[model samples]
Target chain A: MKWWLIAWREIRWEVFLDRASLLRTAIFVVIPIFFVFGNRGLPGGQAGEATIVALALQSVFFPSLAGVSLIAATFTAEKENGTLVPLLAAPIRDFDIVLGKLIGMVAPVLAACAVTLAAAYALASYRYGAERIAHTLTPQLIYALLVLSLLYLVTTGSVTMIVAARVRSSRAAQQLAGLVIAISAAVFGGLGVVASQLADGWALVAVGVLLVFFDVGALEIARRVWQRGEVIGRI
Target chain B: MIEVRNVTRRFDGVVALADASFEVRPGEIVALLGPNGAGKTTASRIIGGILAPSEGDVLVDGISVRVDPNGVRARCGFVTDQPSLYDRMPLLEYLAFFARLYDVSSPDHRAVELAKLLGLDDVLAKRLGAFSRGMRQKVAIARALVHDPPVLLLDEPATALDPEMAQTLRSFIVSLRARHRAILLTTHDLDEAQRIADRVVVLYKGRVIRIGATSEIRAGGKPSYLLAFAGEASAARDALSRIGIEAQPAASEDGLAALRFATDDPRRTNGAALRALLDAGIEVVTLAAEERSLEDAYLAILAEARQ
Candidate 1:
């Protein structure tokens, strides 16, 4: 419950009210629309599939990357602004603080991803025909778009929080977050390609399992690393 | 009700606070005074349970910080030099958020009550980013008090405030003592501490060198008295010399000569000096004791600690 309160405040301040963060979300949301229209150049049947892949990639990578940037800034920004000390002084558990921040940071990014996918879906349906769009929307693709995006968010968010906790400055944290996002994009991109060529839904399911492992490992590491003493010492 | 017993904190083999022990009873304010790098902040953080001690323990209302830090923290409210507020959040919302964090019942009502008490009622709707340094400090204080904790740890709460604002804050802190909140204030401002602190613990190089009442620390040296006379300077000097009393010349007032001197026994030495002056036919107009400021005693104490 305390963690929820913390998460609510983070969402309100960092997402809804912060102009810079809102603008960043807006940019990511609009980028998927361009991807939707760009895929129109491909030939009929293959074009629909490419559009799904492209939109799903954008949907997974872009907003998760945005979330990584935001999560990475979580502690470093608090340190820079001198808010970490007071927050750490509060009675909340270190686990609660980390969990609250994780939920808070990922929620906004997921919301942005949903909006991006919605806009892209409508645009692709209008640019291409409804039947063609419907033909490409398989269960596997839908699973990839939704579950895979969430896994990617949790994995990257947790890993980036580890980097954020260790770093001294927000700029350094953001740079490291970018590096983490790039590595994630490559790994997930390769997995997507292999899943498409191999056993389709089964391969995608294996990818989801692997991401779950990654999310669990990263979350455990994050929880262990995020100690109040360590955080205050860094500050 | 805050007891920091034999607490030591080290960072990377460097001792920041070493074997420090102190107590702030209910309804008392103890000032933790030190120079730069003296570990005042470290001690405060340890007491507030923000940092674990490398050795020993701190107990807030008998809740051991080592065993249950969160429980100790729940009973303590910490305020640092910087307000460190979310600039975009309104004051009311910010206070309410902290109140809820502390699990206070009726958090919104508590926030409003604190705002009104801190004289921020008119600006409850204003965003904290637009506040001045003093106002931000007040907001920080309000947030700390929203839970109505039994112990309050204030680290340089009036670092950058204007003189008037500092006075207001000092008065407010003094008022908190009546509510029986044990307050441990860490500061570089000796005057502020002297004004409000019931007792002071002087820390030098992470060690508690002196801990005593404010007046005791201020009068840390031999007692001295000043004598004002209606006689010539040479006569006054000679009259004191006859009694084996060495008196230094002090500033004259209203066409009268004055001399200052220290005595181990004021009652005996003062009476002898006055008798000597009368015997010398020199009129002794007035005799008064000189008061030493806390700043003077603090410097002397630090100098001795360095030795």
Candidate 2:
């Protein structure tokens, strides 16, 4: 279908080997590893662990922001540069654009996620110097980080793209996406504070389940909204 | 064939178009002519499946845009005045993007043919941002035509072109007719519309005022003749009216006479005037036939509508 074609084109399927996305993803993950451990010994308190986790979250955050730029840049830049009309007039559906955009957001987001995990692992091993990495490098921890990163991608990227689709300026969309990031960090930070006190796994699972529901719901909403039409009329 | 019936569209609190109706059959080029703020773009957008009309139905090849926008877009090609494209992309890449979007199995053929038609083959690989506006326009046109849709809608497609490029675009439109694509073009350039359109549609305030063949709509040598007499055009007109004619006083220049009459048959009006001059005892020194222009008739219609 034409819709799938748009998604494929948007995924930069042909440009998967491009260095820009790879560099953006790698730099996002590796930079924090540098700042977190400057050839220093490990800290031994609950506060240090929390800070380390928070730093890990930041690594997840910044590179994910790059994905935001890519998503917003796709639509807004197209509008500014005059490619929106031709694409809109193509024999494709609006849902195709939405799906294509969503597909496009995934790779960069996943790359950012990959970089975040590597940075987290590197920072853990360097600061703790072979002690904490051995203890915390469990299957549970890896799965938890993967689940958390996917949740972040869905929660942040969907809201960011919806805002992008509603605005004409690509810069404005990216800037607006910064707000979504702030809001997401606040919500997650609050949830983290609350979940730290929960009695068991059920509570965290409930929230994770809710996040998945919202993520799917957001994609569905995005698909329908874009199908309605573009952000602005043709000039 | 595309049929747009009673299409109306509103934006926020303002009505952009209302009670607009028109149709384009196969192989016809209909120009949607209007001044600024006349909702010409809205009409074109609706036909192109860009916007859903607030009311009425648009059927393209019997497919409704509102009901099946994807289907409608698949069958139509729309070239807006300013096409938004990626600055980093090559022209051919952009064309290929659209061709693939339209589900062209062999996009290379569509891309090559469209580039050739729009004369964009030379710039197919050039970065779009580096190209001039005219070059970009050509690429946009190529993108639209890549799908081989039966219907084409161009909104002031030649707005940024120089005279020669504009002429080439006009001929390109004429070539689309040979492809049997039904086209509806929106433009304020009367000369361009006059030259390229098979039928001209004059729209004002979101409604059609006139729709007919271009020659009929722009019959520059109008059939109205005005003559004025020094004393009274009635006596002169009375004599002139005798030969199946009707004449009225238009004006008096110096001491000579003048009267106005409507006669599509110039031969009949001329013969009647010659006989009337002799019968009225008016000096036969000078007799020149005058004709009203298409511009005059069109302007008068607008003036009357305003009143």
Candidate 3:
């Protein structure tokens, strides 16, 4: 129950109270939309469709990176500022702590991703005729993109939460998170290039299912490693 | 009530506290006194449920910290030297946030009440980061008391306060005992401890050297006498030297001299000195035993422990 309270507080703090982080999220979400619309009136071809898909994916990717920052700040920043002591002193379970932080971070970033994706879709329909847009927008691709975004959110959010829990210093956690995100983006980009070749419904569903399993595995690992003693003792 | 029974805490093979046993009953304040590195903080942390003892157990209201730390924490309020408060939050909001976390029925009401009690009513809406050290300390104190816990642990709560502010904080702490709450105060300030604590436990080198009523601990020191003379001080000094007694002039007036001397037994020594002064024609105005100071007793205990 208290963890849900913490999650609510975390979301409110990030979305409303922390204007700077909100502005950063806005910039990350809106910039890619500008890029997608800036290429208006370009001739439609295989390259044009690929470019649109890449722009949409970029929108998802940036917010996913932003999710890492949110997770890092959620755990590591509290620890760094010394507020973690009182928070830990409360009658809160360790699992709830991690779960609350995950919810807190993932929600806002996913919301931003949704908005970015919507803007991308609107711009694509405006740039090309509705019929052309419909012909180009494969249902499987849309489903894969949504699944891929969810997978990225969970993967990056879980890893960032783990790093934040283990690392004592907030700055170190953030820096380590940046490194992890960079490596993840490179690997995901490679997978995306291959995924473009097999844009079938079965393959997309298979990958989505696999990613869900991976998300659960990562969450479990995070839960197991977050010992209250080691986290508080490091300070 | 809180009990720390034979608790020991070690860090990297070095003992921070050893066999530390003490209890604070309801409505009583126990001050843990020691110099730096004396394990005062470690003992308080163990009792606060923030640090687990390497050995033994700490019980708060009959709940063992080793067995159920969360249960102990729920009933304990802890205020450290530097409270880690959120800079972006208003003092009132911060209090409310913690109150909610503790599941207080009415968080805003509790926050207002705590702010008023801690003299923070005027600055309740001010950001905590903008607060001065004294203001921050008050808010930290308010934060601790927000839930009205049955026990409180304070570690050097007045580390850098001015004399006036320190006195205010001391009075406030003393007032808490009236609420029937058990309080464990850890501080290096012996005078503060003596002034506020009903009982004191002296720690040295991670070990409990002594624990008793403040007056009892003070009475362990050697007794001294203050004598007032109406005549010349040198004459009294000379006469006392002749009688094989040594006395130092503590003060002097136009026609009076005050002397101080130490003795193991005040009654017998004062009698012999008075008789000697009367025989030598030295008018003695007043003679009284000087009260033993807690500082002197603390120093004596530390010296003895060293030896």
Candidate 4:
């Protein structure tokens, strides 16, 4: 019931007004501009697939990574500064607080990711004709990418929440979450290299399946471990 | 009403509270007085439904804390010892935020009312980060009262405030009790406890040593007074002794001598002692009853409990 309160607080105090949060969002914006403009000189058709793959990878990493930072900071900072205890002490349930935090953090990053993807799509359409772009952006591929992006965002957000749940210091939580993401990125990047040896569809299916498993696992872990008393008490 | 029954809290293996119990009824202020680590905050947290007790239960307005904590929390307002608010928000925004959490009908109106009541009207627009400690405390108190809940748990509510502000807070709490709202306030300041609390609950080492009316708790010991003089201390002692009064020479600084006297009735004993001192030519520079009347009783209880 107090999800709205938590979301409003995150927006008012952590998002719209926080300089660090704004700067991180700004950084995401700049990444999309770089991708669109930097790849303008690439040839159309088959060459465009490489650019598309690059854009997909960017979507998987930037927004998800940014989401991790936002979620971890939002939770851990509130815990550290004593604000979380008051909110927890309120009539709102623990799950609602977690849900509100996820929405508050993931919503903005999702919006930014949408803009980045759209800008990349528009630039691709301008260079390559609408027909070529549409053929390349098959419904199946788009669906896969969308599923993958959602999984990445949620997986990162949940993992961050899990880490921040036990961590008492906001800065430490942020650093630890970043470290986990960085390690995951390294493993995924290695997998990306291995996927280059396999067929495109098979690779996408394999990686997407793996990400789905990870997301489910993280969500389950968070569900079983997160308790209002343990979280607030540790803080 | 709030009932904390046999509440005990343990962190790791160390027990913070052991079988602590108390209740706050409508139209009464229960002061949770204790020394450091006496489980005052722990008991307050449990009653507020923030921290769950390890051994027992807390019921707020008939809602069990363990069964429906949110229900218990909804009916109670808590002001923690630390005013940990979002620094990014204005004072008004902070209060309004809590009002919304309580689902108050008109959050803005409720905030303004609380702010005015806590003397925070002037700084409503100022960022909480820029406010002084006393200002932050006012906002915290205002936040606790934002929804006008039936129960309030304030941990050291008057801490870090000037005497005037503290007095204002004391009066406000008294007024709240008059409205039939149950209030449980924790304070190390015995004088503040004596002034505002209808009943005093003394906790020592996670146990409630004493709980009763303020008069009943403070009624244990005879009143004591301290007299500061600028003449021969030995003579003053002799004068008090010759008149069959017992006086102990306390501390002497410069040419002033200080003596302590305790009596069952200070009004009668003080006059006799003063007359005896004056007649003996001991200049009575200052004569006043000692503050912390409740403190004496508290320590005596602690000492007795320890033994």
- Please tell me which predicted candidate would have the highest DockQ against the true structure: 1
TM-score, predicted candidate 2 vs. hidden true structure: 0.83
Identify the candidate with maximal lDDT. 1
Q: What is the overall TM-score of model 3 with all chains considered together?
A: 0.87
Per-residue lDDT for B98 in model 1?
Answer: 91
Model 4 pairs whose backbones collide: none
lDDT (10s digit) by residue, model 1, range B84-156: 9999899999999998889888989999999999999999999999999999999999988988988999999
Candidates 3 and 4: which is better by TM-score? 3
What ranges in model 4 sit over 4 Å off? A40-47, A186-220, A223-226, B91-93, B119-126, B222-247, B250-292
Candidate 1 lDDT over residue span A1-235, tens digit each = 7889889889988668878777787777777777777764546567557756677568656766778888888878888898878788888888888889899988878878877776776777787766676678665666658777788888888889887888899899989988998897788778878886877557877878887888878777887787666777777
Among the numbered candidates, top TM-score falls to 1
Worst 10 residues of 2 chain A by lDDT: A226-235
Give the per-residue Cα lDDT of candidate 4 at A128: 58
**Residue A135, candidate 4: C-alpha displacement in angstroms:** 2.3
Q: Quick one: RMSD of model 4? A: 4.5
**lDDT to native, each model:** 0.86, 0.73, 0.82, 0.80
Point out where model 1 deviates above 4 Å. A44-48, A191-207, B230-252, B255-257, B275-283
lDDT of 4 by residue, B73-159 (tens): 888888877888899898888888888888899999888888887777888899999999888887887887777789999888887
* DockQ values per model: 0.76, 0.50, 0.47, 0.63
Candidate 2, superposed: residue stretches over 4 Å from native? A1-4, A7-31, A45-52, A69-73, A123-127, A220-230, B220-222, B225-298
Q: Is the docking of candidate 4 incorrect, acceptable, medium or high quality?
A: medium
